[model samples]
Every structure is written in structure tokens, then in C-alpha cells.
Target chain A: MLFKCLPPGAEIPGRFPGPVHARGKWFTIDIHCHVRSDKAAAMVEGNAAVSHWFLETAANEQSRRINRENGARTRLQGSSPEKRIEDMDRMGIEIQAISPAPRQTYYGADPDLGREASRAINDFIAEICGRYPDRFVGLGTVPFQAPELAVAELERLHKSLGFRGIEIMTHVAGEDLSAERFRKIFARCEELGLVVFMHPDGFTEAASPITILPM
Target chain B: MLFKCLPPGAPIPGRFPGPVHARGKWLTVDIHCHVLTPQAAEMVAGNAAATRHPREVYANERTREVNRQQAERNRIQSTSVEKRLEDMDRMGIDIQAISPSPNQTYYSADPELGIATARIVNDNLAEIVGRHPDRFTALGTVPFQAPDLAIAELDRLHKSLGFRGIEIATNVAGEDLSAERFRKIFARVEELGMLIFMHPTGFPEARRFADHYLVNVIGNPLDSTVAVHHLIFGGVLHAHPNLKLVIAHGGGYLPAYSGRIDHAASARPDCCEQIHRMPTEYLKQLYFDTIVFTHHQLEYLVDQYGADHVLMGTDYPADMGEVDPIGFVEGAAGLDDAERRAILGRNAARLLNIEIPAAAG
Candidate 1:
């Protein structure tokens, strides 16, 4: 909140610009902000898991209301780049490293569907960063259900987009992040020097406190 | 640190008084112990929802069979005062802060029924503590769904019943304790200077945890993890900094996999917007019990939380409980004599407000 954003593409001379970069001696980068990708959603529209995942609530009363209320607000000021810039300025945020919300990760969907959706999301993030190089950075996602495909996409995103990192869910479906199969994907992220941001869509094993015990 | 069972002819306490213990200076306290009151159970009879649990309904045959045997053992071992005392003596526990079982908290019943059930449950614990002042303490329960009534019960438990603390489910019905509606309950507990002991009953997502009893194994810990994370992320911890909330099952899965929480707090502005510091830092403020079931696991908890923050918890009468609880700690290399004593009794005495009587001459 203290530091303001530097003009787009401004770089400090004689200094290695790090993740936050320099803005009046302190760079302000919001590592989280959700940007929905219509392309990504369309790619995975056929998966029942993806649809079920979208409807899952972590069982917080206030959160459910907020999501409900945001639907009306979203109509007023959609996630346009210019609108986001206005918000960042209002909140005193400088550069925002953005990724799609956890629903777009598609860990439970069909592997091929997930792969296509991931590429679409990554491309969308890349274009946004390209358009506002000074104010935005891209964080990609991969089709983590199929780790091999996920690693391949990691390589592709890194080589083409030169993005800083990827956003991942805490668990892949009901599987833990530490499951042996997904270790290779993490290993690839390390090799590419990318940040793996993990966020949880809900509790593992579908453990909602509100849901009734099934017969 | 050694004891031999007292000679049977010489008034050997009850079931088994265990070996004659060596003259160890430290007292041992079992903070996580459960008792099911017969009166309360009878009251809730025919009310199936009062006792339904996801783990019970969804367990495989193997688990169901095991639970049946465990329930049988619990009935014989927990209902009889003489049997419980003998078992406590055998286990080398100096005092047990007994509370209602997770199933008997009765939060789903009508608010009036919940209140009545809590009273019966609390009275049963108080009577036990009243009879054995040195050997037992009471940890009451409340109807969390009705916060106003919950606060009143909290007051009655503390002032009238002389309870040291309370045992609460990880969530109420479906709402987390972090819900705004429940803040008054937490606020009252903190104001009254009472400890809040949290235990998990079940996880309700059936398909994800349908077999092999994972609803208890994975689901229980996950439930605690979710509740504590909400308390952390939802700003309950911030509002009541001094709330002595102790979590069951070794503080569950969060401590082990806390890197993700920290990463999110740093990346997501909203994650840390309420809290003053990183998420993992708050792990120190809370307390944990030693029912994790492994020496190395116990050692790690002591190491992470400091022995002072770790207390002895044997989920008594349950098959999953830490059998040989005192010995479990004695095996942990991380705990020296002082740290071991702190975890075994001294810390519980300080927090639970128990005053250890002078050793018999």
C-alpha cells in the first residue's frame, strides 16, 4: 500500500530486477488475483467433474453470500484490463501477478480436456501480460491429473511465455500434493525456476462440514 | 519411571493398579479423555440424527466390525467408575480432564434439547470430578448452534460446575466455529478464561471417503485442519489472541503441510489481510495433544510446538487412542525430563487450572 506503481516497462539501471522489481525502493506485487478464462472453460465444458467442482462450496455462509453478491457486481465492472488497472490504482496495488481461479485448474477432468484447457488459460494469461507488461505478470496452470502432460506444458509455457510461475491446487482431486505421481511435475517446475502457488478449492476427500452423510 | 502391579491381595486399586511406580517427581495428566453419560444417551434414544456420523455410515465391513468390538470394550471399561479408575492407574495417568464424547455433544437437536443434553453431560462430568477431586477434572460441552444459549451454558459450566474447559466439535452442524454467529461463544470462552478443546466427529463428503474407514483416518484430521485454518484465515485468531484453543489429533494435518497456507498468505492479499503475520506463526499460539500414535510423531510435535504447547491426550476407550500413552512420550528422544514433565502434567496444570496435591508421604 505504501509504494506506487512505476510507469509501464520501467527498469532499474545497474540492478537485477527481481520478482517484485523496484517501485520507489519497494516493489508491490500481488501474487494472487483471479482472472477467468472463457476459452479454458469451454475446453473443459464436457467434464462432469469440472461442472461439479464449480458448484462445490467450502461451506462458509459469508463466502457463499459474497460469491452470490459478486455476480451482480461483476455485471457492473467486468474483468476488463482497464477496469483491473483502475482497481489496482484504487487499492494502491502496483504489478499484479495473476492466475485463473482454482476452478480452471481442472485436475479431475479428462486428461486431454484438462491439457487443452490449461493451454488456453496459459495463452490468455500470456496475452494479458503482453498487453500490460508493466502492470501484469502471468502465472500458468497445467493438467495435473496427467503429470506427464503437465510437465510437457510446463516446459512449453516456460519456453514461450517466459512466465514467472504457475498456480496449483492443494490436492489433485482427492490425491495429496505429495502423491508420488505428481512429484515429477514439481521437479519440472524447479528445473524451470517457476513458483508453484498452491490454493485449495475445498477440503480433500470432499469433506464439507455441511453436507449430510450419504446412505 | 517404572512400576509393578500392586499385590492383588493388598487392595489392588481396581482392574489393574499396574506395577508399583518408581518415585518420579512429575505428575501425569491426560487432557483428552471421553465419557458417555447413560442418562444423556437414554434421552437421545430413538433420535438417530443425534448420533449419526459419516464415518459410521460409510465405513467398510472391516472397520464396522472393529468399531463394534471397540464399542463393547468402551461400555465395560468406561461406564464403571471402579474399572475406569483401575485403568487410569494402570496407564500411569495422575488426572484426566474428562469431557463428553464427540457423538453426544448433540448440536443438531433442537436448541432446547441441545442445552438439556449438555447439562446432563456436564453434570455427569462434574459428579465424576466431584467424587475424585485429585484424579479427574471436568471439561464441559455446549450447544454451539445457539450462540446465546451456548454462552449461558459456558458460564454455568465455568462458574457453577467449576469446569476447567470444554470439548467442541470442529464445526457445528455445517457451520464452522469461524462463522460470525459463533464469535460470541469464542469471545465468552476467552473472557471466562476457559480452554476450548476441539475434536472432530466426521467429514460429510461421502464419495471421496466411502471405504476403509478413511472418514475417520483422513477425514477427522482434515476436519480439524479446515476448522483451524478458518480460525486462522477467517480472523477468529486475530479477534481473540488469548483464546487457549487446543486441537485434538496432534493438531491434525495442517502442521505437516503448512507450506501451502504460508504461500497462499504471501500470494493472496486476502489471505493475510486479517492476520498480523504469516499463517504458520499462529501454530505456536495454539496447543496440541499427543495422540498422534508414533514416537517420532510425538517428538516432531514437541519440537515444533515446544513441549509446553504439547499436552498428553489419550483418546480413552476408543480403539484409535494412544494405548500406553505415558510410555509413548518416554520413548520420544526430543523430550528431556523437564520437557517430558511439561507435556505430561505441568503444562496442563497451568492451563487447565489444576493444582496437583502434595504427594502422599
Candidate 2:
């Protein structure tokens, strides 16, 4: 499948430091990014409020406090693939490892439906990555709540779908990644050498170091 | 010799994973705790204002956006030491490792005064820890703005005051931990074999991760990620092979996000300079705290990094701490008793090189 924009090894504009004289052209890659598309948001909007609440106030107020302390902009809502690419171009980011939002993780979702949702989200990311192969790479999502299904999806993601790695939360709804239920996923990830991108999901709201401060 | 109100054995009373059944009987150790006194706050107030800005809403909505996105309930300023100790008692935590706030970091202050202020802060911390030796163990503050003076203070902290380790931000002011100016401190820390408990201040404005709540929510983690990233990618780890770095906040998203770093570093020459080792290899050399609060998270952390690399942490006085840290670790799935022991206290003891008195066991 041909992705939009340039193919591999094609020269893309770069973002470098210092004056243009001192700075040289460099390849760009954003290893961390999210899948916040209007379509993606719509697909998950029914459950968005719940996910947002959990995500918005994780670690009690640690997330909020840290955000305030650090003086960052608001969270990234879903953006169009075109806009993302344009932004990438502007920033000279050649490739981004894109995945779904941490709140969208389907840990507590119904196993069958969770598997389906995971597939949908993964498909969407893959399509976006496929559109810009030189500019984007997909980090597939897993239904970690359903390990067997998670393994199946991971296999599909790696083999059939051709993703670089998988995206997982720091915990599954307050459960740590080290739980017994996740042995298969961990082993498979290790065996397959699939990059397990552990994103935070406000799982332990009662225990965030950064979140303890007031806004 | 027993400290007042410091119950026998541990200040926290109870057995592993159990309630505070026995008041002040169990031996609990809070490896990561902060002791903020009014005097310390006053000392910080003058210099810290430069770092702190009033929450802006209109012209700089990014500030508000970041605040709204990352605001929390627990106010560090509102906390008192007595209340902190009381809470510690309730949580079954015994000894606490206290450090000064970002103000005491003296990043924006004059280097000389930064050194003096650091000594004063360390002196105050030492007095508090001394007052309650059984309940408190301090990780002294360093004046990173001045490296030589920082090392001198570390020696004073270690020899004179008996602080176990030196607390440092992920970056010294704006410089990466692996930079040339800070190498002396890292070298001294490595040579002394004292633990370097790395915490993040904020990413440099160039990164501006903290500017959009991106800094704290994503920035702090990314900052720590980048800090460790520098150590791994910048050859800091290679140079200081024995540098003992204990990264706070579950290694700040690095262990989990490592594959991305390794993948990117391998794929891009610019990402990593002529480095042969994977990012995760250098990561293994570093230790992390169990500040990451979920069972499965802890499980994966232990599984990915191994139990020995994990230590107990409670960023006390701040709202982000687990009220029951021991229970949280014990309750995490798949950890055996030995793993539990290693994580809760032993790992910290080994890393800090503190003697786990045979008498305690």
C-alpha cells in the first residue's frame, strides 16, 4: 500500500536548532504522539465522557498540578490526518508513532466489543500511518483486559497489519502491567520484540507525584 | 536514644499488606518524602517567585489550559510535618527521605547564595531528621548551579549531616544531567557511590513541554525520559558506568516507552550518536520507584525491569502519594513475598547503599 507524501528515503524538510548556517538538515521522528481524530473521537464519543473524566483527573490532581506547574497547552484533541501531516511538516517531524488516547484503552470494555473496538482503533491508526509511511508509523492498541484477544490482535497487528509495536497503558484500570493476566501479552511482546509503548491513563489517581500540587 | 513518639521498631505500626493493627510497632521506611517547614518555605519564597508565575488566562491561555489540564486537589503548601507524620503513621510508613523544594534548587538564584541556601536547607532538613531520626532520613539538596560547591555540600551532607544521597532535578536548571558542567557532580556521586534520586523540575523552555501542561503531564515524564534518554543516548551511562541513578515517578515513563526510544535511536543517527547499545540496556542500570500507582502497572514495571530495580516511594506532603504504599505494592498482582520485600524496602536500601540492620529483619 502506497502511503501519501514521500516514500522511504525521500528527502523531507527538517527542523534543526541554531542559525541556518550552523544547523544542518536532519531526519525527524516523533516517537510519542496520539490518535485524536474527529472520526476517532466520534467513534468513541459515546464512552468519551467516562474516559475523559478518568483521564482528566488522574492521580487525584497530580496530572492537573503537573500540567499547571509545567505550563503546557491543553491536551490534544483529535486532529485530521491532513492537519497532523501539515503540523509534522511544519515541525519537520518525518515520522510519528501514533496510537489511540490512553483513555480509549479498552481494558474494562466488554471482551468481544473491546476486541472489535481495538481492531477499529488500530485499523484507523494503520490507515493514517499507511497514508504517510515516510511520515508516520502505527503503534497498535491491544485489548489488554482480554489477554487472549489482546494476543490475537497483537499478532494481527504485527503480522497481518504490519505495525512497529503496540501501545499499552501504565496499568489496566488501576491494575499494573505486571499482573498475571498480562503474562501472555508481555511474553509475546518480548518474544516478538514489539515495542510496548506504556502511556499513562490516570489509573492511580490517588498516587501521582506530579498531581499532588494545586492548580 | 529513642526519639519521641517514635514507636519501637518502625514509626508505622503493622505487618506487610495489613492494616495499622499495632500502633507504632512495624518498621516502615518512606524512601521518598518531603519535609516542608515554614522556615524552608520562607527561604524558598524569595527566590522561588522568579520561577512561579501567576496563572494567566486571556493573553496566555496556554498557561490556563495547562493548569486546567493538570490541576490536582492535594496542596503541598497546605501540608504540615506533624500532619505528614500522622499520615505516615496511619499509612504504616516509618522513615522518610526528605528533600527541599524547587526553590531550594536555587536554579534561578545566584550560584554562591544557591550554595549557602542549599546548606541552610540541608541544615534545616538535618535538624528535622535528627529530631526524628527513626522517622526521617534526608536526601540532601545540592546547588547544581555551582558544581564544586554542590560537591562540597554533598560531602558535608554525607559526612557531617549523614544524608544518604543527593536529590537532583532531571535537569540542572536548563542543562541536561549528562552535560559537561554537571559531570563533576555525577562523577562525585558515582565515586562516592551515593544514590542520586533524580526528580524533574520542568523541561527547558526550548522544549517548553511544561508550557502547555504538555510540560508536566507530558513534559515531566518526557523530561525524565529525556534525562535518562541523555544518559543512555549521550554516553553518560557509558562514561559513568557505575552511576547509580534512582529515577522518581516509575522512571518517568521511560521503562514503558523505552522501545520507542530504542527504535528511534537505532533508526536515526541524529537520535543517538554512534551508540551500539539499546536504550533499554542503559535503563536497566538505573533504578525506579513504585510511584506508578496501579497493580498491572507495577506488575509490568517489575516484569519489564525486574523486581530488584523497583523500590518503594511516596512523594509525601504532595498529593500524588499512595496513602498506603506497602499495601499498594503488596496488592499488586504476581509479586511473591521475596519480590515484595525487595520492592518495599530492600531495593531502596541496596541502591542508597544504606545498611539494612540485621536487627530489623
Candidate 3:
């Protein structure tokens, strides 16, 4: 049976996971969802200083509690592609446009470390999309603190991995997104038709209760 | 006959401006307006080599074009009090709390030059406001590059000239406003109970922003965001809880993105070394102006920050300012009469401590 809330003129695609909702008829797509690969989680775990900095400087009590719960769930649902697909199917979601969690953006890490983390995260995302082509599309992350490195990675993700876009935080190291230093990345994104998903990172100071909402 | 649109319970002030739809009985104050006095213009023009740094730092074809267009428009409208008054009347603005144009802050100049320029700008603003007290009030400029000089001038403006507030740039010679050296100025301003109008100068890091006029558009708000973050995380807000601060460009990206900061602080121990409260709580203590361009955005600001915290702002006389200040507020959905009144004028009036004439019984 078709979902009652489905919009008019819906058509179900033949390959839909279950019989109830047809692809064209009632499929739902969530454009702004996040995924956390085990490799990315390991990377965050290894970077204790940066993680501590984020927790100390960015997160508050409520966020800490939520992160503890979400962190546990992300380890299960975010890491295993099968589990993610299962969750999506249960929720009646057809496709999810997934990017790495905002905490994984890691613009504050050392430039080389940041690039390494981004590569690992982006590769993991690409692998998930490759495994479930119909169910998931991938967005990549880059070390925005180093603009040149970010642009270079953007090109790689677009050309090789086929990422549709890259995610960026609103500010880098307290520098505004409009700073001239980041022009090359913006220019490359414009030239490549790469979508830019602007997200906010935790505030720069180590002791505030302000952080961007997770998409 | 009474104005049809005035809300039923609104007090009919004895001497309000003539009726305008949805804005008849209340005073409409524009707290975020800018002015460029002729003397400050002449000073910047005459000091070509000194003033060239801001342009040269971002020398590009687009930057040149944007700067040229801004200079032309500002020369016309920003400098002329008569032009400003006419525009305010057209926009249905009753009082414009005019501050010197962001460029005139001149925080980058040598200490002496900065102080002299500030005095000239302040004197000109005083003269303009003095000429028409009912239509205008003014905020004085300070030589923030020199904090001692800035404090002295702040004292002079407050004591001698009766200025109610002081205008400052987001940064002082590339230093954030939250730096320790500037603490004295903040403390003094708090002690004086004077309003701090925090306006962004040209974004210090404008290299990527040269194209698309993003320098003013995105850059302005970003500057304010950075400044406020420093104030919050750096412990300025914690130290002086009663700063009476008003951030332009709707407090930049802070109000909307505050929840994230809270999350970061909670999950990490290192993020909370300065203050113990949620950043939004401190943010609530500060005020914002409604210059975000859309009614929905303004309404969101009002919702996020209560009506009392959001004041009416039109970047005044600049091309980027709200074209119809009154209509922008009136057009916003979900605002009741009292909310509209608060945002339109009452909030600003209360902040500035100006008494609106009560209605004649």
C-alpha cells in the first residue's frame, strides 16, 4: 500500500527495498544526513588533543550527554553500511546524501594530519556509496585551515571518487569564511561545479556553550 | 480621525509623526544607521598613502570596482545630513542613532592621526545631531588603535558632549576586541553604562572575499561573529556582565549557531576554561539589530532572541542597507502589535534611555 502522505504523481521504482513505498510514488530523500566511518572514528580517537580541545572548548553539558548517546549509536549505525541501510529502510527513506560528522572536519589539526584525516574519511564515504549506489550519495570533507590542501583534495574527490560536494565549517581558526586565503578553494569549487555545504564548527574559545547544529 | 492600523491598546503619543500604515502611533528608531562626516572624508582623501593600505591589501579589479561604487554612493548619501534626513523620512524612520561610517573608525591609522580623525568625526556627528535632536541621535567614534586615547575620548564624549554610546570596529589594528589590553576600555564603557555599538570594519582577511561583494556581505557578519566569540570565550562577557553591547548585522552567525558551541563545550573539558554559562545565555544579554535583509530572517532573530533584544537597523544610506526599514518589520509574519512595537522603536528607546512623549489624554 502506498504511504498516505506521499505527494501526488508519485511512481514507485522497481528496485525499491520493500513493497510498500514505490521509488517514484513515495520515496523520501534526506539531503543533510551524517555518517561516521569506523576509520574516521578511529582517527578522531587517536587525535586526543584535538578531541579534548573540541570537548573542552566547544561542547556543553547537554551536548556532552547527547554526544555520549549519539556517539554510541554512531559507532553502530554510522560505521556499518548494512546497518545504515537497514536504518534507512526502517525509516522509509529511499536515499541519504551523507557527509562526515561536523566534528570530523578537523580544521584545527596540524595541516598534514588534517589532510590525512580528510582523505581517510572521504575514502570511507566513497566506499559506502560504491557499496550501496542506490541508497546513498557521498559528500567529502577537507582541511579548510590549509586552503591549498583543501582545494587539492576537492579536485581528487570530484575527479576520482566522484563526490558531489565538500563540507566546510563557517569559520576556520576564528578566521571568517570570506578570508582571501580561502579563495583558491572557492574558485576550484566554482570551476568544478562542486556543491559547497557550509556548516558551522564549534566556536574558537575553549569555554563557550555555543556549537553549530548537526545536519 | 485615528490611524486605522494602530493597534488598539497602543498609547497615542501626543507628538508622533504623521500616520503611516501599520506604523502610526509608535516611534520608529533605526539604531544601525551609519554616517560619514565630510571632514573625515577629506582626511581619508588627503592622506592618500596612509589610506591606501586597505585597498592595496586587497588590490584586484573587483575590489577596485566595489570600492569605487561604495565611495561614490557614500559621498552622496552618507555624508549629507540633509540627504540622510530625507531618506529617513521616506523610510518612515523617526530617529536614526547615527554612528560614523565603519571606514571612518580609522583604527588602522597612526595613534595621533586616529585620535584627530575620531575627534573630527565625533564633532561633526554632534553638530549634525545637534541641529535636529528630534530626528537624530549620535554615537561617537574612538581611536581604538590607541586604547588610552580611546578611553580619554570616550570620557570626553560622554561628559562634555553628552553622547550616549561609542562605536567601535570588530578589530583594533588586527587585534581582536577581547584582547587583554582592551579590557580597560570595556570596563570603562561598562562603568559608564554607555552602549557599545560594535560595527565591523572591512574584513581584515578579505583575500577570498574580493569577488561578489562578499567582503561586505559575508565578511561583515563574520567579523562580528569572531569579535563576539572572543568576548564570550575569552571571558569578557563573564567579567563584565553589564556591557550594554549591541552587535550589528544581527549578531552575525552567533545567535543561530550557538547550540553547537554549547555542544562542543559540554563534550570537551578544554572548551570551558573561561565561562561557566551557556554562550547563548550571554548572547541573550547582548542586543542585535534587524538588518538581515528578509522578514523571515528578522522574525527568526526575534524568535531566537526575544523582541526586546532585536532592534531596528538600516545600515543607512549605504546601498546594502534595508531599503524600507518600516515595511521590513511590518511585513514580517508572526509578530504581534507589542512585538512589532518593541522591535520598531521601544527596544532602542529603552536601550538609549530616551523617553518617548506619552499620548495626550
**Whose TM-score is higher: candidate 1's or candidate 2's?**
1
TM-score of 1: 0.68
Pitting candidate 1 against candidate 2, the one with the higher DockQ is: 1
Better candidate by DockQ, 1 or 3: 1
lDDT of each: 0.78, 0.67, 0.76
DockQ of 1: 0.08
Provide the TM-score for each candidate, comma-separated: 0.68, 0.57, 0.68
Once superposed on the true structure, which residue ranges of model 2 sit more than 4 Å away at CA?
Answer: A1-215, B1-27, B44-50, B53-81, B206-215, B274-276, B357-361
Ranking by lDDT: 1, 3, 2
Q: After TM-score superposition, what is the CA distance of residue B150 in candidate 2 from its true location, in Å?
A: 1.0
The CAPRI-style docking tier of model 3 reads: incorrect
By DockQ thresholds, what CAPRI class is model 2?
A: incorrect
lDDT of 1 by residue, B131-169 (tens): 999889988999998889999999999999999799999
- Tell me the docking grade of candidate 1: incorrect
Task: Give the poorly placed runs of model 3, Cα more than 4 Å off.
Answer: A1-215, B1-24, B44-60
